[model samples]
Target: MALRLSLLLLLAILPCIVHPISAAANGRALAESVDAAFWLYEAWPRSQKPARARAPNGFAHHLRLGMGTPPLNSTFVFDTVGALPWAQCQPCVHCLPQEGAIYNPLKSTSFVNLTCPSAGGTGCPYNFSYGGDAFTSGYLATETLTVFGRSFKNITFGCGTLNQGYYDNVAGALGLGRGNLSVPNQLGVDTFGYCFAPRATFFFFGSPPQLVPNTIAATTPIVENPALPSGYFVRLVSVTVGPTSIDVPAASDLLIDSKSPFTFLEPATYALVREALVAQLKPLKEASSAACGAVGLDLCFEADNSTNATPPEVTLRFDGDANLMVSEYLVEMSSRRLLCLAMLPSSKGSFPVLGRRVLMGTPVIYDLAKNVISFQPVDCATFGATFAR
Candidate 1:
């Protein structure tokens, strides 16, 4: 369910000094207002067979929102690493089959096509390409975006005429990255947060509530590298598995991305982590070898009951005192009684990525103005209570 609530109780009287908005003049008051808040809803990731036919367990998480004048509601994959929001538009040259009706701009009275020079220059076109040969090309436009009972007018978005990718049953995606065109930026908010849970993932577009007392909150500075400016970059100092702590290379950088389902580490780092985990799980060697073959996971083991299995604790230590922990088993084999590691080697020279698996049940707060990201462990089932005044 989508709910629109104020940020007054969440951030108005918070102890920390809230950052001021640096966007356009119209957004200045919005940034200072304690009443500012955006609607948040539950998002879930699902498994689907892409063109390659390889079914990775949980691929992506999506949230549903209402758009246009009459409110054409659709499901959108929540991509924290992506920039702009785009939906399948009418007069498509080629489009994938969607679950609901593809958005028709003609049907919306508030839809306006943004043309040349005025809207980011000449035709105002945009194209986004993802890994695995998936891409979407379209033009820029403004439309009224409505979530819950609140309405945002003249919000900039992409109206895709051609879209092709492994979108599952969703209409399009909602980008929540650091780019100027991202949802949080469009809303003129310097902060946004989310709590990922197996059942229901909660997202907030304004200032998030302070960390609950006694919660394991850790804050770290976000790296400001010009080469990779969009995504959230966190410096990884080391990783700990069980009793062994593996120091990461000085040049290694870790990106926290929600789009990627599984965590990825550089080849050398992954090897070290793998070796450490293998040594820690030596008692289940025989069962792991058998389950690896059956489930196609690199590190797998047969477990009579996965819930009761005592998995080794894994911690990712950032540059500061921030340490994100992942307890319990990482992966669960649905077709069989097995559990596997949910991390893999990064593609060649790519930087390491901290994905959804390691972030489950963790409430992550992205402070844009302060250039810091805070993390805390919490009971995700009850995390939504913070949204209630």
Candidate 2:
């Protein structure tokens, strides 16, 4: 099991939900190690099959990894992390605020809503899906991408395939193969035009579909998030590694995922500010009235700037380590407004989930039984590198 969480452990790991509050669970999250999922070929469950177990069969994505060692050799590691998962539990379904929405992160950070197209309403627009029945839950997938190295966490880009998607979960996608995040939707090239990140040469899923104006009106920004602690939707609210672990009270009981990414806060001016924010986490410790309201004040993650050719949007970065986390801006979905961040703990050894930030923008198909996730990035052509298992 990647990281087992027994039911009893749930209470300790998951802070039990009180009216508008999130409960705290107890227990050291079970930890185990498996070879990086992306390093393997033959999809997943099938690879686990006795058949293609010999070599990392599909390591043909060398070109997609980068233009030789120039970019690869220049690998610079930083510290930070971000979101994921699936299921049809009530907690996961939330309505995204569409217009004139007052986003008070302290009281209520965001919203969620699930409307299956077949059921007759708006399904989640983004491919970030939790478990749900096909009739109501939507789609589920576990996708894996075999890149040359672990240089980047989750490299975002538009693929001529799928509907020019977005990267929500990082290593989660790599372990899970790509497919219909929500059942009715399939992110084939026909849907998403060629994906693109301007000025940046690489788009992990390859060139994306053409850019059409997002229907979301500039004035009416729709915010999508399942910020409630109910049913099965659990917000990976914050990850504060290395810093508060010892000083914080009974902090060890918290469910710090194994192989989880670490956002190393290098001591810079930005680091100093992040240190202050660490002290103020008291209000955000739970989804209390003030915490809900404080959501809007989460300046630790984003900034408002408009130097780019396109209109502005929100982006995320380290609280104080701005210089190190700066490059992450290129892959940020928007750069003008604000984004959200949860405190994640630090990791000693780098794993796929910990090293890379965002993997595929498209949601994936995670066949638990098969133990493999496959994604058709544009075409199989982008796949390179040689794999021997």
Candidate 3:
């Protein structure tokens, strides 16, 4: 049955402050208006962690938006390398239970089912495999998506009837990758940026937020990987622990992924980093394998709450002299006494992934038009207020 129609569809959207910029600063004559912005929340709540999934930071975060004409509110985790934006829909054939109300397309007058030419004009089917047996498949459809208070018409997205994997407790994921069907591309925006803070932060589309004057910033070229088209790869020259440098070969392509919970390094490189951190934290005793392994991490420690022992500062030197400095390496696990390394050894031979832990408090700008990714450190909470001004 279709939902009841109402004249007023209340929405929570923050309108971006529209301002003009000189061509010298933007490199373009006209500045793109900020289309939409939304606050981010952890996909997995801290209080409820299954024994097998014990990482304090599940590494996944989600945002909420309204869909359809009547406006059905939905939550979706953002994926930097994924292409399709999808959410669990009604008519569950083989689907995992989601946190909130499932989107019912039949109830949305603005929803349109996309057809496939190969399927004799029938509904187009979309399938995505996330490895480790995690996958989502269903028909593709278009809907009027509402973010904050703005409405975008005819946005294509997946109406998944079959989805499974470690999706946490969210409704679905928004693909912010480089594919044509991705949210940014669909919106016809060449620039987008996001600021991740511990609590609530903003993800902006179109032109990025104006950084304060003389803000410390870094910019690096985004390399294209032909094999993995959707990924955002940057050149990593070397890694340094305090004053000591870790031996990572020059110009290693590191994928900057926001969905992954922890940074993954090659086994050999991880060993050197671990040895350096271990030597620095001699006063703190290493945690038991049971405690560390529970969270799927190799290094952990039991630390005194009042102790002055601190994790060594780690630095990533990218090509073009762009450096990312991470201060805390060992974060509190489930309990105050247990602290686990935020990074991990890559499973088998996967490429190194730069995860969300190192990105927190850093505002990242993806300027696709310029083929550059820029970084600026800011208090995200304070920066959020600037969007309205």
How large is the C-alpha RMSD of every model relative to the true structure?
Answer: 8.7, 20.8, 9.8
Residues 1-389 of candidate 2 have per-residue lDDT tens digits of 22221211101112211111111110011001112132222332232221121112111111122211122111111101112222212122332221122122122212223333433453322243222321112222111212434332111211111111222111112112222111101111111111111111122222222222342111111112233111111112123322432122211111112122222221232244345544543332322334323543223333243232232221221112110111222222243333333223333332112112222221112222232222222221232221121
Please report the TM-score between candidate 1 and the true structure. Answer: 0.83
Name model 2 segments beyond 4 Å from true. Answer: 1-251, 257-273, 276-297, 301-336, 344-389
lDDT of each: 0.69, 0.22, 0.69
The weakest ten consecutive residues by lDDT in model 2 span 22-31
Q: Candidate 3 on 85-149: residue-level lDDT in tens? A: 78888887777766678888889999988765555676777777776778888887888877655
Q: Of 2 and 3, which scores higher on TM-score?
A: 3
Clashes found in each candidate (C-alpha, N, C closer than 3 A): 2, 117, 4
lDDT of 3 at 353: 88
1 versus 2: better TM-score goes to? 1
For residues 164-199, write the lDDT of model 1, one tens digit per residue: 875877778787766656777667787888877766
**lDDT value, residue 238 of candidate 1:** 88
